[model samples]
Target: MSAFPAQPLYLVANGPLAGRVSVPGDKSISHRAIMFASLAVGESRIEGLLEGEDVLATVAAMRAMGADVARGGDGVWRVHGVGVGGLLQPQTALDMGNSGTSTRLLMGLVASHAITATFVGDASLSKRPMARVTDPLARVGASFTTAPGGRLPLTMHGACPAIPLEYVLPVASAQVKSAVLLAGLNTPGITRVIEPIPTRDHSERMLRGFGADLTVEESARGRVISIRGEAELKPQHIIVPGDPSSAAFWMVAASIVPGSDIVIANVLMNPTRTGLLTALRMMGASIDEIDRRDVGGEDVADLHVRHASLSGIEIPADLAPSMIDEYPVLFVAAAFASGRTVARGAHELRVKESDRIAAMAAALGACGVACTEHEDGLAIEGTDGDPIPGGATIATHLDHRIAMSMAVVGLHARAPVVIDDAAPIATSYPGFVAQAVLLGAEAR
Candidate 1:
């Protein structure tokens, strides 16, 4: 199926960016809010929800299962749920457009419910690995008939009163962990997940807020999370904070671009998602925090970033689970630093919406930045704060982060940077072009 328009966008070197911007609500939390609210007994109200394509796919799927989900004129989303184990068998397939989270987590939610649902996705999502999720759900009595290699366009028949067991994660993935937890909500007995390394805890936090009987404890090995099944979730009023991942673009853009001073508002500063900030500070970025406070159940802050002469540093591998989504743009920041930057233990990038390691390496090579791609990471030699040669059109293989990362590349390049298609950005940040223009990015 066609993914994006075959159009190109050019970004010329802009002047200093000076402004404050509030990015959209956290995409991860937005998806969970819709899912959890749709499972609660009473009506749940949500504010600051991300209206991006990915989250809307979750809403559409939930609505297909008989939940009354709608946005009122007052700008609040209200969902009257069908309760746990009350999900109806969809009359048609769930078209999860370009969203791995919606597909995987919904599969878990649909598992153990005695319903048959078919799942399908766009070309890019279809190519992602699904065995990581399907294998675990299979152990819980959910049978799947998938495409080759356990990919999407598959049908799942969930078992009522499914069996529960403990699972150890071979890789660090919040998506997989969340899927199992969502599945556990409808099964009998206790389901346990032993994470090798902790990923984003948004699912755990949101699930707890919705009254799921879940507990997370740190053991010597890793985190052991146990959830009591057949949960009776109560409705909640949720106020989602801004996405730290989306604010990453501005963080990198302001750090390297000359004479730039920008502030990102209402950013989620949860410890699990602040790896990009920590890595940037290690590279000597001039970032300051103001008006820090707690909102809903997460930490929120306003970040004031100023242009700084950054030097490359070794990114800590332990921080990979926290900053996985921000690595592509972090690679862009590494391209402008003064020394060699080494990012290792991030093989997860290989399986993202695109092969981010390969994508960034190729894009940087086209812009005259020296980079070497490894099996797990990237090595980049920066230009010592000088403008890079960038008179090339980089191909974005339907990855939203790739397109946005290259947009930051144009800010410090000697020549304009052209992208093959920026339409994919609508998946996460719909107002990116306008935000970039407001922050002084020359685009046409």
Candidate 2:
């Protein structure tokens, strides 16, 4: 979380984990906070913002586009926007680092303004599917010159007074949904998105909170979201909760490792992001929610989890969108369950920072766990609460989730699991190793 991480992390086989830990602010919400606040009319103050590299990329991009973004000594971020449709063309290319959320979301913001900007990213991000957003934005009059395969290192020419169109999401992706909606912030009239599957609703909620005219109507087809543009965005004070996605690693590690009990504090309990919790509960993990409250209009809770025997079952595909980012850790949990765990309807995993299914599958198999990878998901044969025979070095491919998930595997492995290039963990969970060590795990 400090700067670029150069040292590779080493997480060894450790004793039982106990006590409490709190992760950083929600990555998704942190990106949105800096973005939404930058687009509002007045100075917006955000508390508990995530300092991870991914979200920080959003902060830098917003600042590059002529927004005054600054962090105080007290750790709150303040942003003064040029209002909707007032963003200036950047003088240089926006370096998105390794964040898909920052790239896709900022692409939407730039698409509706009368500006020209270029987006570039790290190697992993350059291979991601940007067409999901670019394709929809093209219909709204934005023009793009992308790298081969519709990848990054692309330039975009924004369309002033862009045409409003109704878009239907072909996939369950929050980034795509948010990109379209963020573009609608400037275009005149109502822009609608018809989602066949519900993704996260953070953008819609924050848009409305910032005083944008956005409405949602649910029908059999899916959720119908309409946004009216050429509107003023009012600044707000936002208190972001802990990222549920980040909390997922500990949730799985505690539940699967023997004699482990831990409490994670101030976690975002939004229904959409709690899919991992629900799925774990269905798998028979002993997780309890306490200190329930509301923070910044989103549900917040403290999770107290104790180790329990888990039985694998068919993971409901509908929960995929909610727990998309948590799948790698969940797959680790599945590796130690009672029976075969089937995770289908998650083809999206193939396109993340790395092919998550393949990454986890290979890592689990390396650790002596039997896992079969499907095109869409994976089927893992659990050891049924047994320690895995580790002593394998996993290739993390510069992916934070892949590195952390395998680190969890190391906790209960008979031998130490050495992660290749654990530097990627700084992308999201910056202090992951320190926290793991604090929880009585041998992580470096």
Candidate 3:
């Protein structure tokens, strides 16, 4: 999706990694911060906002829709909102780049307004299904014209005084849930979503932070989440914590590399997003939580990780929703464990930037790690903490997680690991290479 030329990278066995570092801001929260700020009544200041390409797409879309968004030289981003039901029709189609989150959530926002806008994306994002979000929005009186198979490159027409509906999630997806809730922000009455399985609560937390009328109730069926329509939003100063997804690479890298000890600062400790930590600790990783505190509305802590001999464990299927994005790196971690690691209940990985399970299997196998690809997940055979044969160049499939995951493998491998293209890392973690190098990874 990036216009930059393919950038290949090589990583070899590095010495003991030791450093104290912080990753970029939470990508999920960063997207919401801009969206909510743009809908509030006054100026909202944001600190530690992620400036990655994906988040920038959200900013660009908001600006095109009449939100005054600007970044101060002092590193704080300020947004002047246009108020509820006040979005201006954009002059051009919204280019979402490779960010599915931006496209899906923005579609929800536009679905309840009186605006008609077209949404387009790069090749990778265009292949993803948009029907999941559009189906729920259509019940709210919005109409959509999408590519065959409900893919991207679509046009949506919003409904004024949109119909309020109660819908149940067929799957556990934060994106779909957020889209429906966002549409409810401007509808005429209460819109309700019954989530059979809980997903990330960033949208609900952020909506409440912006003073929207929202509530969650536990019932016999599931968690019933409701948002009142035509609500007024008030702006507030927000400080985003470091992304745990980004920190996962460091967590896995330090655990396997011999004698490696590093401290990752200000990582988000949201319960719904810490499955990787739980899985790694179950594998005998020495990760300690130090100085736990609250930042904005989420839990933040520094992770003190040290080298430990890891053993493969049967990862719980219920944990899939919490660490779905981190599975690629988790596979790399599993490769160094003492036995076989089995993962299932992650069919969602098939729809990410690439088929992560298949992509990781091929990449790891190319590096001489034994792996079996499954319809829904993967099973990897570990080298018992020994160096794996890694003299092969891996195809990244334009997936950032796969690129970074193999980079971790190279650190403990017998030979250098070559990435065909690392450019996709800029979508979320632009400083990934430099940050790894700072932690003693030999990269070029």
User: All candidates' TM-scores?
Assistant: 0.98, 0.98, 0.98
Residue 218 lDDT, candidate 3, scale 0-100: 93
Model 3 whole-model lDDT (C-alpha atoms): 0.93
What are the per-residue Cα lDDT tens digits for candidate 1 across 1-444?
254357677766458888999999999999999999999999999999999899999999999998999999988999999999999999999999889999999999998799999999888888888999998999999999999978889899998989896889889999999888888999999999999899999999999999999999989879999999999999999998999999999999999889999999999999999999999999989999889999989999999999999898899999999999999988988999999999888999998889999999999999999999999889999998899999989888888899999988898898888888888788889988889888887786
lDDT tens string, model 2, 1-444? 225554555675466789999999999999999999998988999999989899989988998998999999999888999899889989999999899999999999999999999999998999897899999999999999999999989999999999997998999989999999989999999999999888889999999999999999998889999999998999999999999999999999999888889999999999989999999999999999999999988999999999999999999999998999999999999988999999888889999999998888888899999989899999999999998999898888888999999989888888888887877788898889989888997765
Q: Which ten residues in a row have the lowest lDDT in candidate 2?
A: 1-10
> Which stretches of model 2 miss by more than 4 angstroms?
1-6
Clashes of 2: 0
lDDT of each: 0.91, 0.91, 0.93
TM-score preference between candidates 2 and 3, better one? 3
Task: Quote the positional error of residue 344 for candidate 3 in Å.
Answer: 1.0
Candidate 3 per-residue C-alpha lDDT over 1-444 given as tens digits, one digit per residue, 9 for 90 to 100: 557688999775458899998999999999999999999989999999999989999999999999999999999999999999999999999999889999999999999999999999888888888888999999999999999989889999999989887999998899999999999999988999999888888999999999999999999878999999999999989999999999999999999999999999999999989999999999999999999999888999999999999999899988988998999999999999999999878999999988898999999999999999998788999999999999999998888889999988899988889999988889999999999889987787
